[model samples]
Target chain A: MTSSDNTERLVHVPLGERAYDILIGPGLIGRAGGEISTRIKGRKAAIVTDEHVGALYLDPLMDSLQTDGIEAVSISLPPGEKTKSFDSLTKVCDVLLEARIERNDTVIALGGGVIGDLTGFAAGIVRRGVRFVQIPTSLLSQVDSSVGGKTGINTRHGKNLVGIFNQPDLVLADTDVLNTLSEREFRAGYAEVAKYGLIDKPDFFEWLENNWKEVFSGGAARIEAIATSCQAKADVVVADERENGRRALLNLGHTFGHALEAATEYDSRRLVHGEGVSIGMVLAHQFSARLNLASPDDAARVEAHLKAVGLPTRIDEIPGELPSTEFLMDAIAQDKKVKGGKLTFILTRGIGQSFVADDVPASEVISFLEEKRKK
Target chain B: MTSSDNTERLVHVPLGERAYDILIGPGLIGRAGGEISTRIKGRKAAIVTDEHVGALYLDPLMDSLQTDGIEAVSISLPPGEKTKSFDSLTKVCDVLLEARIERNDTVIALGGGVIGDLTGFAAGIVRRGVRFVQIPTSLLSQVDSSVGGKTGINTRHGKNLVGIFNQPDLVLADTDVLNTLSEREFRAGYAEVAKYGLIDKPDFFEWLENNWKEVFSGGAARIEAIATSCQAKADVVVADERENGRRALLNLGHTFGHALEAATEYDSRRLVHGEGVSIGMVLAHQFSARLNLASPDDAARVEAHLKAVGLPTRIDEIPGELPSTEFLMDAIAQDKKVKGGKLTFILTRGIGQSFVADDVPASEVISFLEEKRKK
Candidate 1:
């Protein structure tokens, strides 16, 4: 609608008692303390951030809350995915408990998706359940990771192997934080924006293709574009907060994306989520073509667009040696999609349309990966 | 109610997305696989039991599922409160992931409160959220823990420090399992049953007082009593699943109970949950008297009945030097009741009616505990 409405969009996560809002827009992080304080009654707040984000913004944010006369205690966890482990969760809970955090007090998760996921999951378990807010500071967190109710910690087996879908009381996605990310990191987030169109919403994808530069250049259009993608995700999540039916469509590239992340051992130095997602998207296109769900031309356009935007659209660009097709299938098969031991794949029916294809044989998946490896 | 309806009462957990049914009646656990299979939409099942339960009844339960032609896998963890640590959670997740579990596959949690809590928490974190069936093998789990969607593991800071409110598709409470429990364990479970009455159902407490001997002696009324307690819990949980309002009533004695658990380091041998709850109930009664919210006679009845049932109704009965009022206050301060560092104590106006008294001063709580201690 209007320019004012552009400033915020509320995502209603549907969990009844534990249900919460994902507040998206600029300047949200600053106002988050006051907004969340209302939901948690008069309880004091705890902020869980990484050292990197803490050093840059913690004091300023705390000042914003103190200006509103809100009391907040901050606990800075180590930066990186490694911090999303059980040991870290314990340390955070210890801090919260020692700080005298009650069920009514809130935990504010500040930083990227890893921080948000870890803090939210910790909130879920602290004294059985505590309210939390997400002030996601990275591009990956802003458009994708922060919007969904998915919160978790990494395990020895894989990333997000231990966690819960504990939604935040409110999610504050301030685009201003994106300035802190590097150029490569900024472009990497575009992969998720591109995914909205590939999975559903063809027009948005076309708009992204036209306005990719503006979105990455950090302008008004960039914020607007991200807000639209969030709206699409929020609408889907509101309908199926637990990823039951229509929400499954949102995982267009995640099956491949997760496997890619696992194959790289979740190493940020070699692979960023957005980057893996970009390559995973290309593989999805190939998988769709193999299943006759999309034409070869559609696959080519998908690859061309990603490459043009500086996204890795090829498996070769990925650092690790390709695991056997069977190994890849084994990893994918271990995904939550496997019901009754049959793997469920989110396949595309041309651009902007995707459906869950559960009956697809595992052999087909293995062979498809084999073909991609040979090429 | 007619005879058939008398045999069962279904209380719906109002989570909408994570919503589930609490099936209360006799012969629930044996037929649980069939009832849960319909909700989960899969024939393959995993039964997460503890060694204590597996050695006793896992076979007959497996036979029941196999009879229905449902393929089942059983994974048993060691028995005890300690086995519910992070290490055990990892082991459980590994088993489920390695077994190629899908989103639709059901995990049947079979054992006491520990197994139910660990299994349910495992199910919640494994793949974000999955279908779980609670086959409560203890009086505590059947009456209180199983029905609530709350599932979590404990951290060093406290019991149930890391968890989520993950509801099960079905809660199957078979009275037969109580046969395996010692009298002390059974009495511990009764403390929770008494809580239902202390919070909002005075009539149920009256019923328990009259029938305590019969239920403890293992009469048919035991089945009805357990089912009725679950029905009351389910009704309240369905309305307020998140412990925001009516659900807080369920924590009637938990604040004191948790403090005692922490004081004893969660050693069931030193202080069972019911014994702690019984003592907590006495402490709550004393606080009620001090606040002039309830009669001293009412407090006496609370203590007398607990003692009659072989439960410790006073802190002195606990075999250890009770922590100072300050230490207990510190534990309660970190409880789920604290808001802005102020604690909410659930006090009774009378039996069957309770209100959260958040304005209660921490110093008053200390004085009340000391008064009870001197007595």
Candidate 2:
């Protein structure tokens, strides 16, 4: 079903008292103040954004908040994955406290995943948690991070190794924000949009294969895809907010994706998160086929669709020299999903038919990587 | 209830799935591993303690864990309120990560409140949470901080301004450890013991007044008092784990207490937390009397009880010149408990009848402080 440019679809995350809504449409950003004022009781907000996002969207958000009689302040940090660190978290927390952001006041994150993760963490800990709102600016964040309540920072050990599951009171996913993201960045986010289909919505994947161009071009199709993706995620989150059971299904490609990101030393110039996810998704399907769990054609279909949307579908597509298989294996072993030194992966019978596989042999993963690298 | 020295009382905090037991008795520290292993699934443990606590108890605790076939590592921090800071939190988190503390593995806090708060916060965030056990080493911690899931670190803004409600899997409140405490420290903790009585148990308060020496000398009376305090706290916590409602009653004297702690710049020599609470409880009663919430005689009775126990009952009893009334008010205003810029204090009608009073007038507090200084 196609949505109009002005049509805003709402996906409600039902986490009991922690339940909240995600508003997906074109101009939610412009209406942020009125929407936030109606939903959140607080009359004060602190908008945390990066230098790039602040320049593009901060003033409009501030103006909207002021128009609604909400006192708003803004803090801009350097833009990049590097900002998702303990130092940035402490700085954000100190500033939030300095601003006297009370328990009732809101801390609005207005950037990509990095800002949402870091800002949500600060909101969670400051005064033992305060009101949090997510104005996720990228498709990756809007579809995935912002909706999950999984806020955290990267530690020396791994990404998102430290944080709390602080659910947002509301999330405003303005499709218009996508217009500002670079083509590469937008494509990176689409990898996650496509991910929903791979996880459990084969029909959505088939639809994306047919209508991806329209999704990238924007309008009704874009809204439907994002709304669908969020709803799928919300279902998983409501079932397992803490990642104890069914929620591991949401990490369909993350174990492989995270290892690839780590292999590149987290150098965005080489592989941003979603791009790593793209390669990871393909590898997951290919590896499952090697284990005789799925057909090779299913993996080929996923790669073709991802490549059609301009996302890298193979590790060889990544820029610069690749790390050795042993390094990648070490990265995989260190993934936070590891339980009791046993490797867990999201393997599939086919597209949209994934299940969490525990105790996947390290030798199998090693041989799979060795063959894939040679390709 | 009088009991033998071998009697171990258990207070269970039933917070649904987050529920746990507080074991109040002697020799609990010696059986930490056995108790923890039976409850928590993981066999790996990290013991976080203070230098003072570690020097006295680490080896014995480690030996107990080793006996249970649990691999254990210990991190000893500096002993003091100063250790409850963001820097220390980061250090502890890094060490936990370095030790490869996994989600199921337990983080055992083996000291007083400082170690408990800091270690619990780290456990709550590392890998997005792990099993945690608290072995409170002081009377105040055993009776108060260790029971509730209130984990945090102090910031420049105020105490416990950064934290999360991370409950422990088990609390080992070994009364034997309190024997190592200095007299001043034990008395400071006694103030909290008295607070449980003053808050809502007039009978407990009267009982303490009659059997003060027996409770102090340690045995059946001490276990009963500590067990009663834990039960009282657990009841409040089970009812309102997040402090959204009835739990605020538990903060009866903390508002004034925190302000006093801040006035002395959190200097332990001038006033530790429970000492400030002793004075603050009296101040709360006097303020209540001033407001006619209770009779002046009730305030006098409360002050007499605390003073009889060697706790300072008046502001003048604190060492050094106290800050001005306005300065104290500023500290109160900055308290984490303040909501929407209004003062919220735990006021009382009399002993055993404390309640949360919201929107308290700043002017009256100032006048009360001015009058208090004259005493």
Residue pairs with clashing backbones, model 2: none
* Candidate 1 clashes between residue pairs 3 or more apart in a chain or in different chains: A125-B163
User: Largest lDDT belongs to which candidate?
Assistant: 2
Expressed as tens digits, the lDDT of each residue in B1-375 for candidate 2 is: 556665899988888899899999999889987998899888899999999999999999999999998999989999988899988988999998998999999999999999999999999999889999999999999999998899998888777889999999999999999998998899889988888898899999999988878888998899999999999889888888888989998888888999899899888988999899999899999999999999999989888878887899888888898878889989898887888888899999888999988979898998888888987
Question: Please, what are the lDDT tens digits per residue for candidate 2 over residues A244-340?
Answer: 9889998888888999998898898899989999999999999999999999999999999999889999989888998799999999998888888
Give model 1's docking category: medium
lDDT of 1 at A201: 84
List where candidate 2 sits over 4 angstroms from the true fold: A4-6, B4-6
Chain B TM (all candidates):
0.93, 0.98
lDDT tens digits, residues A1-375, model 1? 112233555656565655666666677667765776666674577899999999988987898777766688999988988999878887888888777677767788889888999998888788777767788898878888888778888776667766777677777788888888998888888888888888878888778778888777775677777777777787788888767688888888888887777777678877888888888888888899878888877888889899998888777788767666666777887666666667888888788878888888877888787777777
TM-score for model 1? 0.87
Q: Tell me the TM-score of each prediction against the true structure.
A: 0.87, 0.98
Model 2 chain A worst lDDT run, 10 consecutive residues: A1-10
lDDT per prediction?
A: 0.79, 0.91
